[model samples]
Target: MLFLRSRVEYTKEQLFKIEQLRQLVQKSSELDVGTDDTFLTKFLHYTHWDSVKAYQAIHAYYDFKHKHPTWMAQHPIEYYRKLFYATHCRFVMPRTDKNGRVLVIFKTVDAFQQFPDYLQGLIEMDDLIFESLLMLPRVQQNGITVICDLQGTTRNFLRQFSPQFMKVVNDKNGVLPFTQRIVHIIQRGFLMHVTSSLFLPFMNKEFKERIFTHDGKHLSKLREMVGYESLPAEYGGPADNVLDTNLIFNHLSQSADYLEKLQHYKKRIV
Candidate 1:
């Protein structure tokens, strides 16, 4: 319901603050990280342009990568190719909202059941998508909105959104350098309520307030929240803008140089 905020404004003062944050990052031996304008600007934006807090955010970001080394490991491209073709589980909407915030949706079905190993692949895939979005100036400036579409998943499958698992997710999300403006859960029936209950206890107050839920049958509430024009066709939008996993996969495939650079950066993390 809170998707009406404006995109980040880059005033002259803000630009100066970004430069200060860049110098702080470059000078620190502990934080050997990217000092690109977009990277530093987003960190400053996330911390309200406070250089000290933004520096701490940079440390938190790398600290996460150091703790989860496997998530940052460079696997063969074929692994991702197979994962994409085998299970088209996640897709980032090609369009952004009125505020320039991109919408990332993860549909839940029996796709994972077919490939038991995809669970890990799914996590890695999400990391790739998240990192890819971070590279975009529009995404970095405005932030992102996520929709977990659970329409086709069984109640048994929904059981995985447990308190412990979501707590870990919450902890990890705390360190991300970008803003997550809103999170929408699309589902219906008793399991929807149960899943919501499971996730609420673990979320911090800010994130908890940013969440909104919608039943798959209704389009008006969702449309009012994020606008019908911003959503995919499956969610009662235009037929031409259908959700396509191949588009996202193709973008990542073509970004070999950038992905390689990201791998190189991850390797430098200690």
Candidate 2:
């Protein structure tokens, strides 16, 4: 068995395999993945520092990205904001979970008015999130907390889970940076249909355990896991909720200037 080299013990063969796997990826469509030191290190940790598993994980990641390029493409700022203001999705400010892992929140409502064709947009945003998530500093070794809020939503989110997409989700999800520490699902009683239809088949035993279902009355627990103030008003948190689309759009436009400078700096270190 292979182990993450520096943290644990590893064989020479494992070391060779790491390089071999790196070469394999360099030749693949996702030429940049599985080759960077950060990714190599992160994948190792994800697999208990096992080199072979790390190699396989890296390959799966690149393969998934190539196979489903649209799965996680970054869209324009206005496009993303529309999805957020439409009441279908939102990515609150990044923070850490109880375990210090990066916490990512995704809030969705019943039907997205005007933009009824939410599958493509929601799916795009989901992919964009995971991609952007990789750039986080805490993302390398620290894990992730994916919160799915379906308190007031319909099961429409599951409409995209065809056999093809299911395979894509399952294959790539396993190798994503850090283990999925917990997938906190709010309003499980009313939304189990959504979870069962879309998520259950993609989950393994370990993944299923990481997923915790909560009733509507469990905001305290939600708050405890992910601090209440960080959540938006819709989630019963103190943060500013997008009250109007025009204002939200203006906010995004303003944000682009700041983000350009911020992302420029972010590139050097993260």
lDDT of 2 by residue, 150-179 (tens): 654554655656777777667666756664
Model 1, 1-270: lDDT tens per residue?
222223455789988898888888788777656787756877877787798899888788777777675555366444688777766778877778656788888876566567775556777787787777776666666789888887666665665666666876787778877766688888887776676677778889988898888888886777777777888888877788788878777767765566556665532433
Model 2 scores a C-alpha lDDT of: 0.57
Q: How many backbone clashes does candidate 2 have?
A: 3
User: TM-score for each prediction?
Assistant: 0.85, 0.66
User: Which of the numbered candidates is closest to the native, going by highest lDDT?
Assistant: 1
Question: What stretches of model 1 exceed 4 Å from their correct place?
Answer: 1-15, 71-73, 76-78, 155-163, 266-270
The pairs that clash in candidate 2 are 4-49, 110-153, 110-154
Q: What is the C-alpha lDDT of each candidate?
A: 0.73, 0.57
Stretches off by above 4 angstroms in model 2 are 1-34, 74-79, 110-113, 155-168, 188-198, 224-270
